[model samples]
Target: MCIAYLLMARKNSFLWLLLLSLICTLEYIVYMGAKPAGDFSASAIHIDMLQQVFGSSRASISLVRSYKRSFNGFVAKLTEEEMQQMKGMDGVVSIFPNEKKQLHTRGVLDSGIWPESDSFDDEGFGPPPSKWIGTCQGFSNFTCNNKIIGAKYYRSSGQFRQEDFQSPRDSEGHGTHTASTAAGGLVSMASLMGFGLGTARGGVPSARIAVYKICWSDGCFGADILAAFDDAIADGIQLPLELFHGNEKTDTNISFCCNDGPVLASITNFSPWSLSVAASTIDRDFFTKVQLGDSNVFEGVSINTFELNDMYPLIYGGDARILQQVLVEQI
Candidate 1:
């Protein structure tokens, strides 16, 4: 079977030249899949592939840069035998030589904790490609302009609010916030509830937007998420940057509805921090206390209402004084 892969030349030209002079001169571009058959994430696929092929984590440190947003492929450097072995892997689609090409053209491509009034009119600011079909100003009916490339919403379950079913338009403010921060047009003399009064513009005022309303206030189901991913890939979404939470094990245990069966959204232990954080309703708070050799003390966020009347002995590192052999905790 013919497997697919994407290979890219390293960014630094000098490094490439050094390799050509001292190391192997031959270079090949390889394309490999990241997304799995089920609603499983490309992250999960990458974790599985790395463990199966590489002997250690360091092996992947400088070699592979998996494109998570694209969810379909990654760029890596491999020899003929390694490339041939990749083709036999379960998720491997195809592998071939890199078709090198270059073009000289003037082109461009961001806001705030999301600052809305920022100027995107500077260099590298422009509309998206005309072929893009994303939406703008909240999901609406058939809306794609030069500035707004594409728009779509995925709804697998009818359990959402009645209004949500009407249009992919953002019923919740989150979708709008995300869009505006990335590509909202410059609005002169803008303010938030009469605060931060000034020009309110997105990071890239000229950049066009493609709205994909996949989440909701209540919650997003697994099937709907998969549907959204399918549509996004088909509609030419290049990358996704959503974060994933961590647990003791790499496997996330989160399940996704797939055509064949339900698959777990397994990720590695070293996955990056997750952006999708939710607040908890616990009553307890944590605090930290530290003591220095200079008799200086540091206190952290103290949530407990009670105070201790007794004082405890402390120790400091590098003081070379074990008078009472007192131990000190710096946490």
Candidate 2:
């Protein structure tokens, strides 16, 4: 009887382990499918400046016509009739009103002034993964851990100041690039039918963008970076924790930084809504030699890659076609 009972117990344990493995595999598949294959970082849109440069014809028409304007104040709110009219115009695909919410901005600071060697706590913020708490340069240690989020630097007022909440704008183009990559207007493949097939679009083009000029022109910051994150969290968008994995030999030589492990934990503990993303480049040489290393752990998260240039054109140019392809392929 004892022997029979032992055999039965072993059989049950094996069955349970098999079930768990199956469940994990299914969950991974679902996660991979849901992940977007594009970037969704923030970008700056100086409507006023753009309007001045391009004039009201294309600028105003696109903003008003596209219904993509979302700043403090400017043109009077459009009425339902006006909205209808704009939607009916040529080349018009869809228009969405910008809703006010807490805004999140990201940027890099001047590494020379701020120094990547500075500690994290000194900069007045904990790493994304609170567990990795200690001290390290600004928040780059933490920021680098999660490539999805940009780095933070120490700011001492001036153009990068967070007090005014307006003006200066993101001149560096980093913020604007990020925003466009996240969500920009989609371009039609019909325009490219003859040029072979090239579909490029943002991860979430419909999402409204609010740029907070926080980083320096060269990229560096401190409080402003935290403010941006705080604002984003308060704005009600989900924020994902950062995850870091560092090699002891490599990381030791580095000054400020957090590993993916800590960032992921922080995202899980702090923000509940935002999802985390890991950067994956398509360059076989660069990715293989530097980024990928020996670890295949990041395969679980959604991955998106773009050329070093502005991701907006690609996103705005081919969003619709990509969506269509995805749907058709799924079907």
Best candidate according to lDDT: 1
Q: Which candidate leads in TM-score?
A: 1
TM-score for each prediction?
0.36, 0.26
Model 2 C-alpha RMSD to native = 28.0
lDDT of 2 by residue, 1-331 (tens): 4334444555677555333322222100000011123542211132443244334433333332111111111121233434445444433334444331122232221121111211111222233443322222233222222212233233333343342222323344445455455543354462232433344445664443333345454343333443444444444434432311223333222122221343434322122222344344553231211123343333333223433332222246468888889999999
How does model 2 fare in lDDT?
Answer: 0.33
Alpha carbon deviation, residue 41, candidate 1 (Å): 19
lDDT of each: 0.44, 0.33
Query: Residues 170-202, candidate 1, lDDT per residue (tens digit)?
Result: 455555565666566766788555444677666
Model 2: ten consecutive residues of lowest lDDT? 26-35
